[model samples]
Target: MVINENLKNEIEERERLERLYQNLVEKMPAVSYVMNLEKEFSFTFVSPQIQVLTGWDPKDWIDIEDFRLKCIHPEDVHEFVEALKRSIKNHEPFHHEYRLIHRNGDVVWVEDFASPLLNGNNMVESYQGVILDITNRKKAEAELIYNAYHDVLTGLVNRAYLVERLNQILSRRHPFSEQPLFSLLFMDLDRFKIINDSLGHRIGDQLLIEAAHRLQNNLFPTSTLARFGGDEFVILVEGEDPRRDAVQLADQILLDFQSPFLLDGKTLFTTISLGLVIDNGEYTEPDEVLRDADIAMYRAKARGRACYEVFSKPLLDQVINRHQIEALLRDALKRNEFNLYYQPIVALKDGRVVGFEALIRWITPQHGLIQPSEFISLAEETGLIHQIDRWVMHEACRQVQQWYQYGLSSFPFTVSVNLSGSLLHQGNVVQMISEILAETGISPQSLKIELTESVFLETSPSVNQQIQNIRDLGIQLQIDDFGTGYSSLSYLQRFPITAIKIDRSFISRIDAQYSGTEIVQAIITLAKELGLEIIAEGIETVSQLHWLKEAGCDYGQGYLLYRPMDAESTEKLLRNIGKGDEVM
Candidate 1:
C-alpha cells in the first residue's frame, strides 16, 4: 500500500511539470519550435503561438514536411537553411535576422535564436528555437535611412546621397573602358528670389516642389536629380553620349519651364539656367566637378536667363579671376583703394553744369583703375554693396559740403549718388540716408539719389513708402538708365520720381537710324507730358547734342558734355564755374 501511494504521487508530480512547461511555451511572446535534424529540419513540436506569429496552425506546422523552410522568404531561404545545417552539424547556437512570408502573403521580419539539441551520444537530435517578430523595428530603420538621403521640402535626393553615388561611380573603373563617361548638370532658377520675396516663402516652397516634379518628368530613368539647395538642383547623367544627352535634357528642362506653375490659385512663371560638365577622367573629387558645373551655370546666367553653357578652360579661368577679384574687393574698402569720380550733368539750354553724378572707381595696387562694371555686380552678390553704397553716399555728401564751405554755395549744383536696387531694398535704407544727411550737414536739396529702372521691377508698398520718405527729406530721386529696364509707364506716375535719364544704349543709337531717333523723341515726349526732368545719357556726337536740344531735352551727360573727373579736377571745374568761366 505504501509503494502504490509513492508511485501515484511521482506520476502526479511528472504530469504537473509537463503541464507547467507547456503553459510557459504557449504564454511566451515569441513562437517556439522544436525541429528534427534528421528529417531535413522538419518541425516535431511547435507552440500554439505559431498561429499568432505566422498565421499557421501549430498542428500543421508539426505535420507538414519542411513547412518552415517553404515559408521562409525566397531571398533568405538558402542562407537560413545553410545556417541551420551548420548549427546542427557543429552543435552550436544559431542566431540570425531574416524575412519570413506569412500564410496571408505578408512579409514578416523575425530574429531567430536556436540551439542544437544533442542526445547522450553527443549527436544532434533536434533543434529548438524562438522567432521574435521585429517587423516594426526593421521598418523604423528603413524610414530613418530614407529620410537621411532625401530633401524634406522637395522629396528628392539630397546632396549627401548625390555625393556618395558620385564617389562610387568615380572610384570604379568602367567595364568596357578605363574611365566612366558621365555628366553633371547644375541648375539655378532665374530671379527666384524676387518671386520668393514678393509672394512669400510658402509659395516659394510650393514652386520648388512643382519644379522638381517637372525636372524629374523631363529626365531619363538613368539620371539622378537632387535638390542641391534653395532654388538650385543638380543632376547626374550616365550613358553612351553624356554630352548630347545632357544638352538635350537641358533644352527639355528649359522648355518645360515655359509652362506656368499654379500655386494656391496664383499663376507664376520661372526659368532655369543650366551648366553642364562632361566627365573627362580628370576630376578625382566630387567638389571639383561641382565647382566646374557651378562656374558654367553662372556663365549661362551671364549670357542671359533660360540658357545653358558647357564647362571649358576659359570659363574656369574666368571663374578663378573673379574669385581673386572678389577676395581683393573685401580688403579694397579698408585699404582706401576706392575713390569717387564725378561726371557733370549739363543743362541742354545753356550747357551749364547743374549737377554731378558720383561714380565709384577701384584703384587697386595690383590691377589699377578697375571699372564699376567688372566689380559692382560682384560686390552686390557678396553683400558688400551695402558698405560701398554707404561710403559713396557719405563721401559724396561730405564733398558737396566741402564745396559749399569753399564758397561755391552760389553755384546751385547738386551731387547725385547711384544706389543699387539691393541697397535701396534694405529695411533701414531711409534711416541710413537720414543719418548720413544729418552727419554730413549737407543741404538735402544739394543731394540726389539715382536708381536704375530695375529697382522698380518688384516694388512693394514698403519700398514705395521708403521712396516717399526719402523724397519727403527734400532730396530728389531720378531713374538712371531708363528705357532699358522692364518698368512700366505707370511706375512714373506711381513713384515720386523727379527725373528719368535715358539709357546710354538708346543715346548711342540715336544718330544711327530714324527708329532710334523716334524712340528718343518718344521718351522725351513722355517725360514732357509727365512734367518730369529728362536727361540724355552717352551724348557723344555734335548731331546727338543738336537733336537732344531740338527735342526739348532738359539735361544731358556723356563724353560730349564732360568726362568723369577726380575730386581735384571736379573742384577746379566747380571753382571755374562759380567764377562764370566757360568750363564746358
Candidate 2:
C-alpha cells in the first residue's frame, strides 16, 4: 500500500511538470518547434504561437510535407536550405536570418536559431529551433544603408558611392592595347550661383532635380549617375567605344539645356560644362582619375561655358604647374616677394602728372619679375588677393605720406589702388580703409579706390551701402576698365563713383582708321554728361593722345606718358616735377 501511494505521487508530479512546460511554451514570444531528422527534417511538434506569428495553424506545420522550405522567400530559399543541411549534417547549432512568405503574400523577415536534439545515447535525433519575426529591424537597417549612399535632395548617389564604384572599376586590370573599359564625365551647371542667389535655394534645388532627371533619361541603362554636391554631377559610362559614347552624351546634354527650365513659375536658362576622362592603364587610384576629369571641366569653363574638354597630358601638366604656382604664392606674401609699381596718370590738357596707379608685381626668387597678368587671377582664385590688396593699400599710403613729408610734389597728387570685386564685397571694407588711412596719416582725398565694372554686376543693398560708407570717408571712387565689363549707365548714377577710366582696348583702337574712335568719343561724351571725370587708359601713341585731348578726356596713362616704375624712381620723378622740370 505505501509503494502504491508513492507511485501515485510520482504520476501527479509528472502531470504537473507537463502542464507547466505547456504554459511556458504558450506564453513565450517566439515559436518553438522540433523537427525529425529521420523524416526529412519534418516538424514533430510546434508551439501554439506558430499560428499567431505566421497566420498558419500549428497542426499544419506538423502535418505538411516540406511546408517550411516552401514558405521561405524564393531569393533566400537556396541559402536557407544550404545552411540547414550543413547544420544537420555537422550536428551543430544553426543561426540564420532570412525572409519568409506569409499566407497573405507579404514578406516577413525572421531570425531562426536551432540546436541539435540528442537522444539518451548522446546521438543526434532531431533539431529544436525558435523563429523570431525581425521584419521591422531589417527594414530599419535597409533604410539606413540607402540614406548613407544617396543624396537627400536629388535622390541620386552621393560622392561616397561614386568613389566606391570608381574604386571597384579601377581595381580590375585591363589590357593597355584596347580601349578603356569605361569613361568618367564630371560636369557642373554654369552660372548656377547666380540663379541660387537671385531666385533662392528652393528654385535652385528644383532646378537640380530637373537637371538630374534629364541627365538620367538621356543616358544608357547601364550608366551610373551621381550628384557630386552643389550643382556638380558625375557619370560612369561603359560601352565598346566609351569615349565616343561619352562625347555624344555630353553633346546631347548641352543641346537639352538649351531648353529653359521652368521652376516656381519662372523660366530660367543655364548651361553645362563637362570634363571627359577615359580609363587608361596609367591610373591605379580613383582620385587620380577624378583629378584629371576636374581639370578638364575647368578648362571647358575657361573656354566659355556650354562645352566639354577631354583630359590629356598637356592638360595634366597645366594643372600641375598651376598647383605649383599656387603653392609658391602662399609663401610669396610672407617672404616679401611682392612689390608695387606706380604708373603716372597725366593731365590731358597740360601733360602734367596728376595721379599714379599702384600695380602689384610679384618678384619671385625663382621666376624674377612676374607680371600681374601671370598671377593676379591666380591670387583671386586662391583668395590670396585680399592679403595682397591690403598690403598694397597700406604700403602705397605709407609711401605717399613719406613723399608728402619730403615735399616731393608741389601739387596734391592722388594715388589710386585697384580693388578686386571680392575685396569690395567684404563687410569690413569700409572699416579697413578707414583704419589704413588713420594708420598711414594719408589724406583720404589723395587715395583713390579703383574698381572694375564687374563689381557692379551683382551689387546688393549692403554692397551699395558699403560703397556709400567708403565715399563718406572722403575717399574718391573710380571705375577701372569701364567699358570692358557688363556695367550699365545706371550703375554710374546709382553708385558713388566719381570717375570712369575707359578700357585700354577702346583707347588702343582710337586712331582715325578704326570705329574704336567713335566708341571712345561716345564714352567721353557720356562721362561729361554724367558730370564724371574720364581717364583714357593705354594711350601709347601721339595720335591717341591727340584724339583724347580733342575729345576732352581729363586724364591719360600708358607707356607713352610713363611706364610703371619702382618707388625710388617714382620719388626722383616727383622731385623733378616739384622743381618744375619736364618729366613727361
Candidate 3:
C-alpha cells in the first residue's frame, strides 16, 4: 500500500499534540504518574514535580512502582492498597488522604485521587491518578477537628465527639462480634460546683485536668473516655458484659480519685457518680441510650452521691416520662395548657388582701391538673422554665389588668410572680417582664417578682443585671423561703431586694418548738434590720398568726388565710369577706 500525504500529516500533528500534553503534565503543580496493573513496581509516566514534592527525581520513580509504595507511610499502606483493590474491583474512582514518607525523612500529607481505567472489553486495565500535596489544608482541618471534638480545659473528647464515636461504634458494623455487648458508663464528679465556688474555676479547671488524666490512666486501653461537658464523662466499653466490666471499671475509677489532687498547693478531693447501662440488644438507638445513661447518672447523684447505679427499666421509664413532659412543655404555650391561680397575700395585722402570688398550673389534655412542684423543676432542667416564666408573667399581668377593668381597682392588690433560676439565667428576664407589663398595661409596681434563695445563689452577674433591669422598671423583688438558705449579709447587699419571706418550715414549727420561734423571730428581726419587708408563710393557727404579727411580719400567706382558688371562687370569697360572711 502507498503512503498517503493526509495520513502522514495527521501522524505528525498527533505526535505534536502528545508532546504538548506531556509538557502540560510536567508543568502541573501536582505530581502525575501512571503505572501498569500487571507490574508490581512499574511506572510508565512520572511528572517532574515529583522532585519538588517528595524530593524524589522523576527518573527515580519511572519503571519503579514499588518506590512510591515504599514511600507511603507504613501505617497507611495497607488501607491504601485495600482502597486501590476495591476501586479496581468495582471499576470506580478512589480518593483518600494519607501520610507519605518524603525523601527528607519528614512526613507529608497527600491526597490520592484515581480512577480505574477500563479497556473496551470493560476490564480494569490500570489506574490513572493524580497525587496532590494537601499537608497544609489537612493540618488546618485536623486542628479544627481536634478543637471540635476535644475539651479545651482537660484535653478530653467533648460530648459531641463522644456521641459521634458512640454512634459510629453502635452501628451495624460495630467492632465487637461477641454479641456486640457494649456499655456506656456515665460519670459525674460530685460537689464540683463547690470546688469552683471555693477555689474558683481556674483552680477547678486544673483539678479537672488532673482528674481527667487520672481517670484516663485507670480506663482499659480499649475503653474510650470522653468529657461530656462540665465535670461529666462518658466511657464506652466494647466486647464486655456491662454489669461485670462496668462495675469493676467503676470501682477502679473510684479508686483513681482516692489520691488528693493538689492544685495551687491546696489539697482538693472529689468523688464521682457513675451510671452504667448495658446494650439492651433491642437495637435501641445511641441517643436514647445516652439519655437513659444520663438520667441514671442523675439518679445516682440523688441517691446520696459517690455511688454507682446500673440502669434499670424504672430509670428508662423515668427518662421517657421526663422526655414526654419536655415535649409537652415545648407545645404547652401554643396549646394554652398553662393557667395562673392567684393565692392571696394578706397583711397579717388587718387580715386584708395586700397582694397575690401567681402560681402556675398545668392543665394538660392527657394528664389533667399537674401540680407545679412536680413539673416546675422539670421545666427548669429542660430549659422550658424561661418560656413558662414568661407565660406566667404575661397571663398574670393580663389578669391583673382585667381585674382592674372589672371595677376591682381599689383592691390595692399587687400580682407577684415567681422567678425560676432558669428564667433569671436567660439574661432577658427584665426585658421579658417589661414587655409583658407594657403589653398588658399593668404597672410595673403592681408586678412583684419573687425568687427563691436558690435562684439568687445560682444567678450569675448577668442575672443580677436582669434583676436590676426589672427593679429599674419599678418592680419589687422578694427573696422567698429566705431563712432556708445559707445566705450571707454581704451577699444580701449584693441584691437590690425589697422583701424576704421567712420559710414556712420556720413558721410551721413556730408553735411546735422554742428553736422554731427563736429562728422565726431572728429572721423577722434580720429582715427589719436590712430594711426589707417580711412575709411569714404557713400561718395556719390563730396562735401562730398572733406570734407572726408580734414578730413584726408585714404579710402572711397560708391555707389559714385562704387556700388557692379559681378566679370566680376567689372573687366570690373576696365579696363574702367584704360582707363579713367569712372570718378571712
How many residue pairs collide in each prediction? 0, 0, 1
* Candidate 3 CA-lDDT value: 0.80
How would the candidate models be sorted by lDDT, starting from the highest?
A: 1, 2, 3
Candidate 3 lDDT, 373-409, residue by residue in tens: 7688778777788878888888889888887777665
Q: What's model 1's lDDT at 178? A: 44
Cα lDDT computed for each candidate against the true fold: 0.89, 0.88, 0.80
TM-score of 2: 0.89
The C-alpha stretches of model 3 lying farther than 4 A from their native spots are: 1-154, 158-183, 187-223, 228-232, 237-275, 278-285, 297-310, 381-384, 401-411, 424-428, 438-441, 460-462, 483-486, 505-522, 539-552, 580-584
lDDT digits (tens) for residues 252-347 of candidate 2: 999999899998789888889999998877877889988999999998987867999999999989878788889999999899998889999999
Clashing pairs for predicted structure model 2, backbone only: none
Q: Which window of ten consecutive residues has the lowest lDDT sum in model 1? A: 172-181
**TM-score rank order:** 1, 2, 3
What local lDDT score does residue 411 receive in model 2, on the 0 to 100 scale?
A: 90
Local distance difference test, candidate 2: 0.88
Angstrom error at residue 46, model 2 = 2.6
